[model samples]
Target: MRARTWRRIPPAARRLLAAASAVAAMALLAACGSDGDSASGGTAAVEPVTVGLASGGSRQDGSWTQAWYEGSQTAQAELGDTVKVTFVDETNSVDAYDKSAASFLSGGGDTWIFATAEVPQLVDKFAKQFPDSMVCGVEAPRESYAANICTLLPRFEQGTFLAGFLAGSMSETGHVGVVGAFDFPILTAELEGFVLGARYANPDIKISRTYIQSFSDPAKGRAAALAQMSQGADILFSGVDQATQGIYQAARTAPGTYVIPQYFDSWEQAPDVVLTSVIYNLQGVSQEMIRLAASGELANQHYEFDLKNDGVGKLAPFHELDSQVSDDVKSRLAEVEAQVISGEILVPGPDVLGTTGAGSKLDLATIKAE
Candidate 1:
């Protein structure tokens, strides 16, 4: 998704707002001690810690980056006075990431990190350079570091499945569309789950899939969505971030066509057209990580959150289309959710250039029978 250009708010005004928000956040964090046990029965001493955040994009983009910001805010609220977040904006280069990490470390940040798998080398370099500082890389594994670095990834397939169910149930044309940022394993997992879910709900469901090759191109996303709709797709599910707003806009022109948003609830963008959202709860995960850090038990490992962990999942807020969804459909969806969380329903593993990854291939026949 090409990032939407903001009407330049004077740089001074922007800086002032950022400073003010940071001050307010710091105050809030100060009031909340690092008490992890208060929420989950893990009593630990409250400590004042300073953490830094690095983003590949702006916090206002309403996408993956915003989700990370939300998580930082939650950590600030729950950890009080111990957290400070500084984001690197429009990070499109490795040099930028390296500089951001170095700056954060030099500035005394207890934890310096970047979100996304695109900056593997930068993350690895920083992990080695600042071994004392905790480092977090979101959405991919930290292949080199073992002690001071950890990776956080979401079970995005879980949410995609729910979105597929919505599309399959609501699609009038029997065709649903998916817009992806890239053709990577992660994106493929989302597409696979969505296709599987749609097929599970309706055997004859047809899926139209496309990759924009970039995560910041709104025009591309909009055009792809329009093309799919033109080809008879009635529901659009996007794995791209801000570009999804373009998809929502495209759906509006089609009246009854619906869209499923990524990262956060986008119903406000098109109340009549947006079916529901497959949201990521980064705030919850960030808070948990901060608590673990405070307890000195933070480990370098891949942490995957799913419907079962309340880490990543779906939200079908009752909207204009609520009445159209049958009671039996809702009940069946609930059953599907339970089965997925309990491991009874397995989403297919990622396919590499059309080949399935490790794990038993999903039995499509059995899934549809359920």
Candidate 2:
């Protein structure tokens, strides 16, 4: 996942990449591998395809990394031994990350899916070095790439809107907390939409925002969640990947606190404390992308996902918290969903970050110290 790809993009430009389709694909090669193509109509030896999954953290990270793990598992299950999958975890170092991916490709892996955000920076290198192999970053930026490389981005702000609405409606302290691994463009969009959605339900909602600057430090996630709870946040969002486990711990210890998981369905982590989750349907995306590749059309065109697009961005099952979310709140959420799909609600992205709700800023000033 390229969590913070567009950090330098101006806020307005960020808006373009946020609330809309967000995925812009610039395909550079003529369609190859089409069924119509054959070597003089003679049958050639077919090379079997193998998928290699690489991540910066362990599968226990419970969010970004785990989501990709599940996606690959689903793909493997669907392929049923036709496609081989090799998984490598804990490759955060740039050199190690590069070597792992290259090793996979050199070891008969013809296709790759990278889970680390920074891995995409070397994508051009990978495409040039291993032209025969195509590479994809799970959540990557919008930049033109070789016909062998494609970046898929999800409009996550849509799901955060519904989560924010739930937080606002269920909060007992009128305060909600957002804790993230990094303040990347996508995460900024999530924060913006969260504030917008929360305030949409309760105009007086106060939000506390924090960025831990690391994706795998559980200690940081725990401390951040506790800090937010101490500041009167009854509903919190764990935007960190592996660190999210610590976030759930904080919410569990608190008497009446709720947490929202990111990138995957994490309600099973804390059945009662976790009210709902913003699920990124990467499993479905992986299946679709694989099909496209098999059909000779995987490269060039970028894939965009949001709630309105093939269930890319979605809310997980209500689980046991259906009663916790009142009928009015659920009804309002349904109505908001329609509005978001129709563009009636302009949930701010990174561009409109500082000021999101009723002229209030999504700054640390709102967080209480007590």
Candidate 3:
């Protein structure tokens, strides 16, 4: 659950040259165990397998990094002494992240998780350099098929669509808005999905979208939310990080307004106005990756966590706001979820939605489910 300062090992001449198979490595570990007593029967020691994680953000970011931190703890709890999870946080720069990874490898760590975006290249680079070790890149743009590489892309749009549908159904002003952090492709896809879902639920609904260009600036997020609220948006969705607090704050002042946040369950932050959350389930996904690596069955390909996987792209419980959502709304939400998971409703990815925003030209008729 926590990252510690690991003793640095010089990487110049200490790099592991020979690649070892997982089976061979396991056998070597067993052989290194303390010998059993001859006079009295004694069990061989259980050699702990160490796994390292490198993240660009702090472990307590209350968002992405925090989820992975909890996941590591969960994996360790489940695997017990058989697996050891250690992490190095605040590796924000490329050089820092690479150095941390190299240090981990130099210290005999076979499996390392790169927890952030734009890491598929590094995953492939490290995987090729250390074929014996399993390398995982979280939130990677694409799949890496190298023998020991694991790339991940969580289908967050699915969950966002569900939340947007809820907002569309519940909005009294016939308008909903999204306050996004940036206009990146992934975030754009999520924002577009919300728009599509809202329109699906209520074709007459109006959407107001804004990009604050900052993830940690609460003032900017609040200002965007307030501006949308002034334009008669009764329900709002947040695609920002700590800035989401601003949306929550704005919701508090405007009675009957609701907010939906992404990444993790944030109902506790504003229980009064939080309708629900679009969760990526980073904790669950991370735990699965660690388990696979530990068992030596991790595949070399891109991993997608979607509605069908039951790994990510799910909505959190509606806690205190449960009574506000009608049974009909809940039923429709469930039906749409099944359709998306079954491929009947093919939610478009970012690539499919080119430069989307409020009032953007769209052929809604062409987006129907097959």
- Which candidate comes out best when scored by TM-score? 3
Q: Candidate 1: worst 10 consecutive residues by lDDT?
A: 351-360
Displacement of residue 323 (Cα, Å) in model 3 is 2.9
By lDDT, the candidates rank as 3, 2, 1
Candidate 3, residue 118: Cα displacement in angstroms equals: 4.4
Q: What's the lDDT of the predicted structure labeled candidate 1?
A: 0.72
Give lDDT tens digits, candidate 1, residues 1-370: 2222323667787789779999999987865753433444334554456666666777877767777778777777776765555656667566878877788887667776577656756666777787788888765443455687787767777778877876787678999988887766666777777877887778788778878877777888889999999999988888887777678778878888888877777777778877888876765666666666655566777776777876477665757778767798788888887788787876643432122221123556655325
Name model 2 segments beyond 4 Å from true.
1-45, 80-82, 138-143, 346-370
Please list the Cα RMSD from the true structure of every candidate, rounded to 1 decimal place. 13.2, 16.5, 10.2
Best by lDDT: 3
Each candidate's number of clashing pairs is 12, 6, 0
Worst 10 residues of 3 by lDDT: 1-10
Tens digits of per-residue lDDT for model 2 on 189-273? 6766777678777878888988898876879998999999999999997777777778878888986798888777888877878
Off by over 4 Å in 1: 1-47, 140-145, 348-362, 365-370
Which model, 1 or 3, shows the larger lDDT?
A: 3
